[model samples]
Target chain A: MPIIVNLDVMMARRKMSLTELSERVGITMANLSILKTGKAKAVRLETLEAICRVLNCQPGDILEFVEE
Target chain B: MNIKSKLAGIIINVSSFVIITGYGYTLYPSGIHNWMYSYKETDSLNLPVSQYEALNDSILTMRNLKNGYGFDHDNGQFAYLGTQTSIACDTCSYTWFKNNTQTYNQNYIKLNAWGIKKELPYKFYVKNKQGYVRKAVPVKNSDSKFNIVDVPVKFRYNTMDDAILIPVSADGASLFDTGWLILWGLNMIGLLFLLYLFIRFSYDTSKGRLFTRKNVTRLKLIAVSVTVYPLSIILLNLLVRFVFRQYFSPEVVLKDMVWYNAYIVLLIGIVLSLLYGAYNRAQLLQEEQDLTV
Candidate 1:
């Protein structure tokens, strides 16, 4: 619960559409939307790696540790 | 599913249906069941007059002490048909006296007087081992045999108040004559409920709804029915024993209670509960997988 997803902020900074990122990362828009909306319970390392590679960002840029 | 789980489910379902159907067939008739439960002693009622008189004189006596209607030793120790009695001992008190009796509104007390009272006009059946008929008898000929066990019996007597009529050394008042009927009714209700729940579960499974919320609820319901049905019946049996102790012996009720018949349900309940847990976890995993990237 303390781990918060910041995928929307990174995507915004990259000025990329979810549809483009999904196509580049070989993941569905639904899964990308779930990650963006912070609804995903987990992210596979391969999926994270693909998203980082496609978005040109680190995993830390899309995921953040929140104390609360 | 492996062959074992599939086989287990099939066995439980089929066995339950078969047993429920078997109960329907076996318990619908009174004579057939009585014949099934019939003791080896077919000639128990062939006692001579002198021996019966001697037994009446020596042993303690229980009369037809009911005010309105009562069992002819079929329902309890006291009955309506004059003062009909079936068994002398306490152990077999629920034993059918197996004869006819007539109603009387007089207060009569004589241990050996049922011989004349048995010849009154009207007739009603009293069940048990052969005992004296103190009520009025209209047709004493061979035609009377047809009327036996055909009449519905009713019971009326306080469990505690009847204690005075029973001797301390006597075995006790008992009622096992119609216990099978109660057991049969309960089993039918339980089995029907089980069938209903199972049908829905099967429908969900057929639609590939396994590990869904609906399936989880179905599994839980089935498990609860399987577990609660037998337990409630046993509790009712125990309740009968406790509540009927004033008139009918608890031991006799316990002996005929349908506790053992539904034990298989409990075992199946355990299996379903385990399945429910697995299904619940599987459902959670499925949800997580769907939401996770």
Candidate 2:
């Protein structure tokens, strides 16, 4: 629960809509929405790698750990 | 049907046939020769005793046979003292009856026996109810008016015999009329349907359809049917007793442990229904997670 996904910020920075990013990343838009809304329980390393490659950002840029 | 369902179906059909056939035999046992004459005569009476001075006092009580037998002329009463245990003798010709009520209660004494004999030293089985049983050997007291008996405790519940048939009564042919048989058949049919539902549920689970809404609803209906089964039987029995108050009593109906066991089954059904509800919610959560990226 402490780990947050910052996929929306990265997507905005790259000027990419969720659908376009989903197409580029070969992942469903619904799943990308889940990642953006921080509802995903965990992200597989393979899925993380794909998202990072498509968005042109490091894993840390998309994922953040905020201490409670 | 798939293999799993096919196997389940075969077992279900075979078992259902067996059970229904067995029920039919019990329902119509008239073909058996002289089976209706198997009733034994038992006389039950409550006698009030006025004197009890010590622990070994020979309590004297008397009852009339005409009042005890009532209208049950067939006289089919019997008691298996200690069914599975050697503690009580099955063939001990000694004429004595065990106290049905605990001796600690001092006012009235209750007992059931075949016949009563008048004598100086009466043989009686003394029991402190629940667990304690002893044989009271009576002897003439010093005053010669009252008898004194020495009772040595024989067995406790822990050491009691395991395989004894307590009291078995055969409801004579006259007792099982057409109406009673019809009611019993209806109850049996309900049970058969319950078994069918159980088989279907098991077949579905074997097919990996455990968390489907169909299964959830099925389980709920099963729960309700089982819960209602015992309740409906008890209600019917109560109604019969009410209508035939002259012939029936609560003691007669409540003696069967099957009624209480049905309630236990009802409780189990209710618990399963609750678990099914929890599983349904978890199933929905899993479905949502499956669709998520």
Candidate 3:
């Protein structure tokens, strides 16, 4: 419940549309939308690596912790 | 490729394959026979208490008629009036008369050889003023002279529509036939497996839960398969109809085609609804990730 996903901030900083980010990250637009909407239950290391490569960001920059 | 998602895929594929293969094998011998047989037990009531009583009474009356006329040991034939019509019983032969003529013959016999009286139940049909009637009469007292008084009987009007001429016994042995048991068992297992896979698919999270790219793609694949599989059946049926146009009427062909198509469409809608829930979950996950970033 406390897991964090920083997809929105990363998208804004990189100035990338969801479609563009999905293409760059090699994921589907539907999946990119999922990440943007905080619907993911967990994220894989490989997927995180892909996002970092596309947006030029660290994992910590994209993730945060919050108490539920 | 999380464990749960992988398991769900395996379950779906295995269940579909098993159902298709089982039905194909069972029906290949006689497709219509298998289909109609599946409906038979459900469509008609099984051997009810009333039917059993009717059978018992008929057998008892036949035996009484055999005894009353001092014909119990004679081995000669005797005929009497059944509740609905006239029934005749003999030591070796039995017939039922209706409309002033013998309308039924007992070529076959059902004997409870282990019973105290060692009696056999005989089945025959008679045509009366109303119509053809089917009755079961049991006969007893084989060692004594044949008498008309010992035959016990009850008549049952055959009300079954689309009667397949399948023999039914009051003993309930044929109800437990191996083929029927296997069919029902497989259907129950397949349904339970489907439910298990659905629950697992919903709760799985290793591939980032239902909303993740991999999981959603997997779900989409399954949904598409569910949709296309039934559609393929309809398409094949249509093609066959077209190829055999001279042999079949347009109305007959169209009716069957539309019925199956509608069924397929309903199945597709159900699958899509499940996928939509998974997609919505993915959206919520993405929004959470976006807010944190």
Candidate 4:
């Protein structure tokens, strides 16, 4: 619960829509939506690598931690 | 899928559907009707043999004729026990005959047989109109007044070898009161509930809701209900055993092949409960999988 996913912020910075990102990242939009909406239980290392490569951002930029 | 596999799947599905429908149809009302109406009016009676003296005289005359014909009337003990377990079926047996008003509370009759004289040869006889019948029951060899001669049973219930609990009215007038409803009515209701649970299970399965919390709960309930079904049968027998002991007071012996039947259903229920546990774990895993991106 402390780990917050900030995938939508990175997508907005890259000016990419969820459908275009999902198609480019070779994953379903539903799964990408799950990650974007912070509903994903775990982010696979390969998936994070693909999303980082497509969005041209570090994993730290997409994922943030909050003490609450 | 391949054509062969598809065809086989269709065949299996069609056959299963037909079989289930056919089975349900056959079990609707008549199957239960037989169980409810198995006992007839003559099944229970106070005077098992009305004209004991007349029957004895007739047997003696026949024996005399047999002696003249150089045939021996073998005096043997017929150890045939009467099938009617409930001797208190009619109001006369308990209330009027016993002259007890309070006996109506424990109306069912449980009959127990003891002191079987094996030495007495069983005599088979063919009367003029009565056709074939047991010739004569041997009189009291000892001081005990009752002897079980024959038992003709048409019951799906347990082989209740105890006292009979008849349903009687308050004033000891009517034989059949609401006790039959307690037996047959409750059986019908239980059966309907089981059918409903099965339908719900099938509906949930068809809807692809197999590994859900509600399904697991339903499965648990189904298992418990199945287990309770057999247990209710045992409880009914035990209830009869308990109620039979209230008045006139006889030793109780509850032994029947059907009594052992509960163990089989109990084993099935245990298996279902284990399935319920497995399904719950599977549901948790499914939820986790769904949550993962």
Best by TM-score: 4
Candidate 2 docks at the CAPRI level of incorrect
Candidate 4 global TM-score: 0.52
Per-model TM against the reference = 0.50, 0.36, 0.26, 0.52
Report the C-alpha displacement of residue B132, candidate 4, in angstroms.
28
Per-prediction tally of clashes: 11, 12, 59, 25
Residue-level lDDT tens digits of model 1 in B73-96: 323221111122322322221112
**Which number leads on lDDT?**
4
Q: Rank by lDDT, highest first.
A: 4, 1, 2, 3
Model 3 ranges off by over 4 Å:
B1-293
lDDT of 3 at B292: 36
B129-204 in candidate 3: lDDT tens per residue? 1112122233465555432212212222111111111112323323323333564566467547655656666667
> iRMS values in order, in angstroms?
0.6, 3.0, 6.7, 1.1
lDDT (Cα, 0-100) at B241 in candidate 3 = 42
Model 4 agreement with the true structure over B1-293: per-residue lDDT tens digits: 79965654454333333432343233223322111111122223232353333333333333222212111111111111112211221212111222444321222121222211232232111122111111123456865444323222211111222222222333431222234434566667867877787788889989998898888888888888878877776666555445434432222234454456678888899999899889999999998888776
